[model samples]
Target: MLRNIVEEHFDNDPDVTIAAAKQIRRMDRDYADVGDKLYALQIAKGNRLLDEDDLDGSWGQFDEAGALKPDAPEAPNGKRQVLLAKGWKEMERCYHACPDLAIDALEQIMQIDANFREARSKLYALYVSKADRLGRACDRDGAFPHLMRALEIYPEGGEAQQGLAVCTPTPIPTPPPAAPVQVPTVTPRVVLPTPPPPPPNSPTDISAAPNSPTDPPVVRANASSAAHPAEKSARTGCARAEQSARTGCPVTEDSWRTKLITLAA
Candidate 1:
């Protein structure tokens, strides 16, 4: 009885709706009998809260003691009747006469009376509106979960089932290959000059270089080069040509080989 009274008080006050809903659930499994005055007061207040656009308005007025109530006051049934009329008017304006408020009102009613199918149907429609909105958002993934939840709540609901099918993303298609274009090719008319020979290394300069002191000390020309036959070449620094001593191609002349030996010495 106390719990019912508390919930009724809360239903009359939009600010207390959450607390009222909680207390309403704590009441007797069938709400037992908390007095018709108190029960009807809570139901009417709950209806007003659902109807208000702000969803923050009070469901009922005040008492002689100056105490506020969420639901209608019990001692003055006549005053409660007047308040209920006002609440209904406010609800009608806030809800735009849509059946949406019916679902909210029914939800509260179900807490007091579990076997209320009228409220269940209204709640189901609310779910449909929510699912439809979700499906149209960039995060369509979010809508799928709600749709599944709605299906769980109403397994026979065709809207929920149909929405699930329509929201699936379409598969991407493969495009055909583009035709290839022919590009002009150019032949070289001028040959680049061969690179100059690298400089010779000095024994004293090589010795001053860093290395493990314990390693064998040696100084030698660190030169490297490669050349192909039929190419005219110039000698610079310590370079000498020995025809590559290969079998088939034009070999280095004996005179060039002699000059290379002299440079090494």
Candidate 2:
């Protein structure tokens, strides 16, 4: 009966402990009371050994040889043994920090020896509380991994599961798009009206006008009249005026008036 209780305590190996629990629960509830009492005594001793070892006080069971078996080793210590010591320290802190969680682990360990489990359950709970507190204080992703390993070591470990659930990450949210830019329009330049030309009989001369188109015709007439008086005597002066500007002297329109004044002087 004592052996059966040990098996249930290590329910981490579900298949084996489940089988053992099934068979043991069916036996006479009060039958082998002495064996039940002996199992309780053994668990107390085992819990003391764990306390001496400073192990995370989780529930465990014994093997066929009546020797207690614990879960797997925690993560390896770093080169300087820095990371490993940190993990151990954190687990210890967790066990001490949260009384409720520590109690849960200790109670589960003591389940096999109800009397022993109850007597030392508080201390066992402290161990678990220390481990959980350390994990949370570190605030690292590795904390979850350590907790997961504890669960794997003791598949029935409720405290480890709770730690894992809390340390899990949450998802991020997305945002919306921005507004468009506005541009200004520009206008073109405005042109002023051109003044009208002077009348043919006006005292105001047309040549002084800036960029006037009528200057070339007046200059051509003056040049032809001055150079071809004989052509005018024969009534052929109009044709000679056109030819004079083109061939006679190669004189420019500006020089025409000057040359005529010189001839008169």
Candidate 3:
């Protein structure tokens, strides 16, 4: 009966509500067990503080209720109404990109009533939004805490599930094996120079005729008496005389010749 009076005047008359609370405590043999009534008195005081815009004092009372009965619903002292209104206001903050204030209000609403589904849903959505934005920015590790919080609220939510997947540690791609170190093996190629065409009417070195196919063709000469090569006699007798004299050929003494051939006609 005393409790009913407290509820009716909880927000309207602080004096009357406090008096009613005292009366109820006196009437009950085990008043200490009436935690709900005590909680109501605290909420009434908090509402009075809130009415005066004394947010700090009101917070103390509300927090006390949370410490005592965290799962309790808001009291009849306009506490429920204030929390609901404040929650929406904070949501507006969120829209304006003030996430910190928005999150604080949503959490407060939950402290007032743990079963507030709208607050939970919105809070979960906000957390997921932050996580996704951060993940897209290559902050996957930083994004995980937000997704984890969202999951704690709604374990079955698809958004958080996908966000968790986004935060999952992915295997770094193995770099394409460093392009095999190219050693650039240099093969030593022996280049043989092409032998100059036999001098205009001169015979090629006959000694070179029986050599290997791959060998360079050769020419033999004698130092000329003139600035130019001296022509040799084609006489077979000259060769015989050279053989008798121990020279290899009429033009010889076993010598080879080459020219840039600036003299080519």
State which candidate has the highest lDDT. 3
RMSD of each: 29.4, 19.4, 20.1
> Over the stretch 1-265, how does candidate 1's per-residue lDDT look in tens digits?
5565455655455345534444554564345443343445444554454455323333332232112233534525534334444444443453435645644554454455434434455456666676787777755677787677667667899998898887775668878888788777888699899986656673456557777789876666544344433233554311332334333344446656786799999
Q: List where candidate 1 sits over 4 angstroms from the true fold.
A: 1-106, 167-265
Instruction: Assess the local accuracy of residue 215 in candidate 1 as a C-alpha lDDT between 0 and 100.
Output: 80
After the best TM-score superposition of candidate 2, give how far the Cα of residue 246 lies from its true spot, in angstroms: 37
- Looking at candidate 1, the ten consecutive residues that score lowest on lDDT are 61-70
Q: Each candidate's TM vs. the true structure?
A: 0.27, 0.23, 0.37
Please give the lDDT score for candidate 2: 0.48
* Candidate 1 whole-model C-alpha lDDT, 0 to 1: 0.53
> Model-by-model lDDT, in order?
0.53, 0.48, 0.71
**Candidate 2, poorest ten consecutive residues by summed lDDT:** 72-81
TM-score, ranked from best to worst: 3, 1, 2
Which pairs of residues collide in model 3?
Answer: none
Instruction: Give the Å shift of residue 92 in candidate 3.
Output: 2.5
